[model samples]
Target: MSATGPAGRVQPARPGDPSHIGPYRIAGRLGAGGMGTVHAGVASDGMRVAVKVIHPEQAQEAEFRARFRREVELSSRVTGPHLVPLLAADPDAPTPWLATAYVPGPTLNQHVLAHGPLTEGNLYAFAAATAQALAAVHAAGVVHRDVKPQNVLLTPAGPRMLDFGIAHAADGTSVTRTGVMTGTPGWISPEQYRRGTAGPAGDLFAWGALVAYAATGRLPFGSGAPDVVAFRVMSGEADLDGVPAALRRTLEKALAQEPGDRPSAAEAAQECVTLLASQATQVVGADAVPATAVDMVTALWDVPAGEDPAWHLPPDRSPSRKRLIGAVVLAAGVIGGLAGGVAALLPGSTGGGTHTSSSTASVPPSSSTGSARPLASTAKDDKDGTAANRQASNGGSATAESWALTRTAQGAGEHDVARAVLHDEGVVAQELGDGVGFSPKSVRFQESRREVYLSYTLASDEEGAMYAETEIARNMCLTVRDVVLRLHPDLPYRTYVMVKEESGRDPQVTWQDDFVANSRCRSAADDDSAQDSGTDQDSGADQGWQPDEDGLGQAMIPSTDGAEIRVADGAARKIIAGTNGIRRTLGTDRVLGNAEIKVGFDPGNSVMYVWSDYLEWNQEQVESWADLAAGEACRALVRERESAGSAWPYSRYAVAEIGGSGYLMIRSGTATTRAACPA
Candidate 1:
């Protein structure tokens, strides 16, 4: 969701630039560095991400790819408010790429060059925040070899430390290449130059130099040729002129010739925080930021008035639910930065989901093979035959390359398939024709049955969406059958079409069925197996379920056998444990079936939700699957609530297994057991 900034901030992508990378759609170029070009990209769920793709020449080297992979692993582990988090990565791809949550702001160097050196509260906050970022990096056993001014981005929230590209674990492994300088001139530590080794201490040296430079708008060590800077660093020469009295002493200690003499990142952060509180404003706690500091930092940027609203950093005064979810994601460490591509590699993550501004859905890897190969094989079964032939039929090597890229991304479930459709927006639109358009943001894919959910937002209200629902479904089916299905024809493709009102209410499912090119998109009467169209009709005709006054539906639970009840007892015990209870294996009963139900909690909202890839679009199929899952989950909750006399503090819970199907059968109830719980 990288915002299109003013001219110099984000440049248009060149003709040579990639239109898409993995599951992200590249929007514009952010910048280029030694490693590779960084592009502003958007995820399928409209999350803005900063994607860093390695240089082709560098990617050719086996050593570089190994380091890049290590960088991704290490970066994902280091998370903090002042540090950019790694989102997704595929170092094994032809040109290895990694994506991070996009932070829109000028680099520390850029800010200083345009607005001069920071003063008072702004300078103090920057130092403390950057130190906190370093502490987080070091806590993860990573040493950021390059912690220069240009790598720190300034935002209203505080400073964000970027580019752990050269960071390596503190286990003493060498990440440096022969004949390559690991750090920028005038910033590299004396130890790095003299002994050719850098540890966490070197990062401290750079942090001090960075803060000093920010205070005085000059390099701590005299700016000169590389040799001269190295000499200055080795000679322990540093200038702290014009620096504040209290901060100058700390900077002097940080620039000590001996690595051990410098304060630890934690100590430095506390010292800066203390200095800011004493001079500028009162700090509530050691960790709490002062309001004056944030105000000063915000004033320093001077962002243009008409810039994209998406570019605004979250307000410093209040924490919204969106920010709370972000905090949860960073704290949970389960879905830390590595959302799409590398989820399988994370310690206990079954797979990751695409997180949008509001909601998220996790899809486990192909349960059939427990690997990505099956997904690639699905695409290989394209109408044109083998991947090579599919490429030729599509008219280029780019298609083959993109397909291969899709394979790397397939580890994250439907992300690969979703990217394929989004990348071909033009072709999909051409097939849909006038008045009807393909909504890129509305496209959500499910890999299990090759189901793609799409929506059309009407210019009018919900009534308007209902009025044209039939026509919209017909157009959507035609686009999918004629264009999307032809590309990957192997799977029994099922599609769901949703109609959304312009007023922003939740979209309602209008169509849920498979289609073939044999006849024009028709009603269920024409296609016997297809479910009837219209949201209201599907609910009443098939399930005979009605919504309560709150519009919350109830999950229908079937009679559970004694064996299923016993299994539910064990699951109840685990759920009450409050750790990673949902993901742990709940021993299956024959009645429960094989499909695993994975649960997630949003502590911010006090809601627990379940997700499963086994659910389908058909009403009957959904009911069948929902019964088993709902009964088991409900029994577990009932046991915990009744036996322990504790409701576990969750106010509401839901079943959203068929996410992106648009027709989410959300059954909301209290954490306490309900009538649906098996007796």
Candidate 2:
């Protein structure tokens, strides 16, 4: 809930903090750092802006003023939709101050930690937007040396990148600290550590790490002491476990040790946009704002504003200024809110944090202080309701779940969103149970994973296994259709169909996949309409159960050893050709060394296993890789059969495996459209 913006209440101004700096009236404290303090201020025209004012002692130093002037210049030169626009600055003032347009939302780090990692459209959108932001930064000939989660604010519109404090011009006209490192430990580029100065490639490297953090809610380089984390960054060993495969490939290229090996900012942005296109239902142009991402980010704003806290100023640290600046600036671009005075508070106005909070602050000591503190929970119920209402107006589809919710602390009406989700979940459970001919033991929606889990008891027999697989596929498509039509179309969710032989036994997940209703299933009304119009081939029904190429349903069943597996050379050729087409369209160049396509017919199993090197990528990446392959295969199969005047014989579920060792089932059904879970 914490973000650098004008909507939330702020801490009361400290005694030493200026009430009026330039033409802006300081209302309250936004943050503080080594550079100065950031204040929530109002202009003469009543427009709210984050005002960053240098400390009186720092203003006395000529070198400090020159650096402040350089920051103002750099901020002015950079312009983009994803950047916090600088409004004004005056370096010659007794206390140098700068102001920037305030945006209301939580930082990426805060949102990920409070909620969880981003998924689906939100993740894709974030990657595209942040990459575009960097494109702009680079285009302006500015190298934003500090590009991390704390610097990216998630707003209802999209993400806005902050903190240009240490940003140096590509032409080297800026006054950067020559002796100190200018970026966060885990996010810094290897070349920066080796050469002492970072360029646009360094920002792109940070972008790779930042996107990975947003998708997984963990640092790409695992967190530890600054020196240790820096060592990992320099070693070029990033843990991209939870990242999607196709996207992970892009990150891998971006994280390459050599600067020339990394893709340009524009190229990276286009790549992200391409990935977003692969998961979109409708035609999304490169410039289109990702609506689902906007909605997901908007939901994070539905929290009550906190009461302003009392501000207390720390004692001066003039004696240790040099050492403090050297150490703290290298670790976190800015320092403020420290017990010691070495760190000063700055507001979002300046865009770098040294203090725990600031006008434009850097990342905090831990993960908490780099931006605004998380929203407090003490406001009136009506106020929280108002925030929720605003969220609705902003097109929030999913309700924001508090980091930790308690019945009493949140009050009676606070659980409305949770209750609503529960009600919808029950509805889905009932529908799925009715369709599959039995009640599920449990149905739970995990917001963090963006998945719905439904478990049912089935007889331990061949008939039961077949029935479970068939019904689960058919019903999962139907549920996806229902969710898209009656629930949230903007939010993508995976449906996990789990089965168990006995009530006391642990459930075995039969299939789980993100099925786009538009391409995989049709409403009952639409099905009837398609039949009546003699356009069944074009309807979603075409994606349902179908016979084998030999006009046999059960005869195509394969053995456990895959000995009876059959492959149509023509179908295989079509699939491979389609995969290449996709690769070309998306500009994906990463090819696994031992990439192999093993196609076979197995009616009894009805699962297509895609095995890959586990050491190179994790389970999620493997699944993502399989999903892409299967989607291409699905389209190719449909086309090949259609050309032969027949229906697609294969209804195989795609599953991912690690080097053919472990089975990691992925999709319940095939992907019939580009979107992962299109409406």
Candidate 3:
């Protein structure tokens, strides 16, 4: 074990001790740890700084020296308002030390010890700020292996995180040895304790434990020997004696035993901020003025409501106010891993990939056509393929069937093919991969468009991996699907419609012959390959049509004018009729006018539509138009109209065998026009 101060008493500094170390003037000894001693100091300009120097004993260890060198390099690159800014360092010196902007405040542990338990509101605020700090740290691709209350300082500004002694850059040369835990016992995640593989999630687990302590003045695993505490943490049990009910769910999730089970610092920060905001609103009431809220509110005002505060900070402060300012600074610094060169490691650290082993599947370039043949199989295929193939061959005579699987890739990758296949069967496929592999289960086919999503995992039984996996998978699936549909024009898709007033109301349908006539006219102008008038005459005459009761339906009206008719109301619904005569609704109000609709077909009469809603805002109309007009214009862009035929009211707008759905934008008069999917 490392030596402590004589009799465990903090060593006192002598006046004649070298006043200057490198560029800093040593003022006083601040504290001492197992590996190093910290001294209060200042630059030539009298700028306060904290200098941490390696102990002579530890300096003899080559590994420790290298780690200290890495610490200097990492500290220099990390910058944030909440973190103690690393001003200088000299790793090559006989006595290595790092000088950082001095932050003055009581350690969080000291504060809790002196002041008792923190109020629920303050605890929530602290958690949020600390989570944000950790986010910054994680973003930098570094993990503060030691995330204890003692490492956190509560300054006047908020919180400033300190002590990166145990922090390791994701790509740094140093590798943790097995069975060597770098974190405090009680706050370490199960993975950290057992595997010595501390990552961003492990830091999040520590943050959760620290928050639990701050809120209730007690560790979640009860105050006991490190071994017992480690046992409890590894067993996935927590002692939430005084934790608030509102925060229990979040804390429980974050405290899950597995590293994969814990909520991300980003997510935790969001929840903490939300919880804090709710508590603040309750305390100040709805009628309270914004200006009088806590100083934290001032930082939150200019950014997103729950945005991490690591991105912004107040100006510099004087020494007298350092303690208060330092608290906030420390709070900000807690996001240690989110900035600098460390950020590059975040993507791979989450551990996600999707590839059928031993099977070569090539992603076709540009062209849509491709040939798929079964190749070499692996253990997974051997266990499931025979049954799957048997079922596929015997289950139905139809040419297409629905299938679903959990997405295991971080972003767009091979996992999408599975989703596409499931969609072809009219099944709503949900994604399951969130950079982190938390949720391990996925349900491919539910009841029609409404599918059951399952996230049960045997691995999660040991911790919160199940919950984390599920949330990440669902969120990743949604994000990837949405992004792909938005950016790729040729992908078959649909539009989203959000109704604030009518959550459960089934959509109403309206059809107009005038709208159909206008669609035909516009199609003639837009489609260069459209059949000439002679072809139109023959096809129009052959398909004798009649209008519906509402002067809509199979109408054969021909027009020469290139005018497109559209619906003005956003609440309108559009449906494209497929070969099976099933009408698939394309756009909801939210997705209307902003995205285009693409439809795909299967041999079994099943149709799939890919919705891409990438609408650019018309700044002029947005600024000048009335709310209703602006809303309509936005919707129009999403639900733009296109015609299939050249004849005015002929087969142009015919709702026959619609294989897919799409939108076309057009400038028609002063008002923007929108077309509803054919009902």
Q: What RMSD does each model have against the real structure?
A: 25.1, 24.4, 25.5
Q: Rank order by lDDT, top first?
A: 1, 2, 3
Write candidate 2's Cα lDDT for 1-679 as tens digits.
0123333446566444565666666677675432345677765565566666654434555655687677666657766666665666777766676666554566676677678998877787788878887888788777777787767777666677776543331111111111121455577788876666688898899999999998898888774323334555766768899899989999999999999999999999888877776656333444553454333333222332223233333333334222111111111111111110101112121122111110121121111111111111111342233343333224222223321111110211212222222222322233333233232333345555454444444332444334434444444444443444334555445433332324443233343444442233211212222211211233222343332211111121111121122223333344445445555443455542112333444332233332223334545545555556566545544444445443334434343332333234344344344343212
TM-score of 2: 0.43
lDDT of each: 0.48, 0.47, 0.39
So what's the TM-score on candidate 1? 0.43
Is candidate 1 or 3 superior in lDDT? 1
Task: Write the residue-wise lDDT of candidate 3 on 237-327 in tens digits.
Answer: 6767788887878888888866676778888877777777776677667566244323443333221111111111123332332211111
Query: Each model's TM-score?
Result: 0.43, 0.43, 0.41
In model 1, state the lDDT of residue 567.
31
Candidate 1, residues 1-679, lDDT tens digits: the string is: 1112331255556545776777667776664422345676776677766666654544555555676667666666776667776666777777777666654455666567778898876787787778887888889988777777766767545677866533331111111111122456567788876676788888899898999999999877764223334555766778789999899888888888889999999888778867766644343443454454334344333332222334222223323223111111222253333222110111110011111111133222111211001111123233233443332333222222232222212222232233333322322232333234222333544444345565333332333323234434443454455444434456444553332322333233333445553223443232123332322322212222222211111111110122222333344333323222322333222222112233433322334444343432356545444544555565555655565454243434455544444336545444344664432
